[model samples]
Each structure stands twice: as structure tokens, then as C-alpha cells.
Target: MRNILVVNGSVSGDASVSRALVEVAVQRLLGINPDASVTHRDLSHGAVPHLTPATVAGVRAVANTDHELSTQALSDELIAELQAADVVVIGAPMHNFSIPSSLRAWFDHVLRRRVTFSYSEAGPKGLLTSKRRHMRSFDPPW
Candidate 1:
């Protein structure tokens, strides 16, 4: 069975257009693959903590170190979820021409060094090759 991860970044929750788009996408995906499993991470409802100096330090720290932080736990969970997914769908609303803070925070946790990507002498390269679809919502008259 394929694993599909859906991330909702809209502050308007269920009423947001981004979420509606995600729903449609999910329906289409399930229609294609009946055995696919869907998992959701509602960023607005469960806001990801903003990265701090301590969080960065925790990320760089050695595993099983004396200094254990909550950030490490959170990052581990987020990264694991991303790594396990065969497909990812992100629903983000554009605010001031940028992504929502919650969505950005979610990225921060999942986009870990040596986890989601790695740097070589050439350049930074992504480790994740999972199919990703980004759905953006805008103020609309359409």
C-alpha cells in the first residue's frame, strides 16, 4: 500500500480553499490507488514550534547525548513521517507573497541536514525523491 502524507497549512482550517483543493486531490489519488493510505498533519491546529538556537543545537548534537531537547523529538517524528511517505501533498495559502509560518516551521523540522538532503562538493542534493504536489490558495474572484 502506498503512503500519502497531506499537510494542511491554512489558518482558516476546514474552510480554506487550500484544504478544499487537497480534498479533491486526495479523492483523485484514492480513486487511482484503492489501497493507498492517507495521513494528515494539520499545521494550524497543531502548530510546529518555530526554530530556535536551542533547536539548532539539538539538531547538531550527537544522538543519545546528555542534552536532550524536545525539538529533537519533534524533528525525528516529522522527518520519519516524511521519509515514510510515498507521496506528499502540501496545502499552503500565500500570505504577503510568502508561505504561512506554520508551513515554514513544518519545513524546518522535516528539511534536516543529512536527513532530507545532503551536501556534496558539487552542491546540496535532495535525498527524498517522493512525489510532491504543492497546492496554493489565493484571494479569488474566480
Candidate 2:
């Protein structure tokens, strides 16, 4: 089964233009792929885990004897989903000329070593195929 992860970058809930646009594109893709499964991650709806001292520590720990720091940085569930997803749909909106904080948190979790990316002789290679990235940027649109 192909997994399609739709990342709604809107920090103002689903009502945001970016999320709405992403929803429309996601629905259209679903219409074309009835057998496909979709995971809609709404960042504005409290889905983002805060980056505390422990969380930051965990993300940086590669061989921590304790799981506390690692768990705080990235959850098993999210890492698994991110690694398994066949495609990622990103809704990028400008918030003060930058991506939203919630979206940044999502990136932090998704963009990990030996998971989402890896180093090779040709520089860093994306674990995810370039074709898997379906991005739509707008002037506050998805």
C-alpha cells in the first residue's frame, strides 16, 4: 500500500489557505487513487511536539544508554511513519518570511540521519526519493 503523508503547514488550523489547498490536492490524488491511504498531519491542531531540553538532547543522542532523550526528540510512531511514507505533500506558507514553527518541528522530526537522509560519496542523499516530494508553494497557498 502506498502511503501519502500530507503535511498541512498552516499554523492557523484548517481554515488557513495553505491547508485548504493541500486538502484539495490530497483529495484529487485520492480520487485518482482509490486504493491509496493518506495520513493528514495538521500541524496547527496541536500535533507538533514541543522541543524541550530533553527533546533536543534526544535528537542529538545516537547511542544514549537511556531512551528518554531520544524519545523526547523524536517519537517512534512519527519516525516510522516518515520512513514508511511513499510520498510527502508539503504545504509551505510564509510566516514572517519563514515556515511556521509547527512545520519546522515536523521537519525536525522527519529530517533525521539514517532515516530521512544519508551521506554518500556524492554528498548527502535523500532517503526519500526525489519523486516522492510533491510540493506546492504559494503566496500563502498550499
Best-fitting candidate, scored by TM-score: 1
Give one digit per residue, the lDDT tens place, for model 1 in 40-136: 9999866587776556655543435333366777778888888899878888789889998889889877877787888999999899876554454
Per-residue lDDT for 1-142 in model 2, tens only?
Answer: 3778887767665467777777777777777787888987777765666566545555544535455555544555576677677777788789889987888887776667776688999999887664444355434232
Cα-based TM-score, every candidate: 0.83, 0.76
Task: Give per-residue lDDT, candidate 1, residue 36.
Answer: 97
Candidate 1: stretches off by over 4 Å? 61-68, 130-142
Could you tell me which residue pairs clash in candidate 1?
none
Off by over 4 Å in 2: 61-74, 134-142
Candidate 1: C-alpha RMSD to true structure equals: 3.6
Pairs of colliding residues, candidate 2: 58-69, 58-70
Candidate 1 at residue 44, lDDT? 88
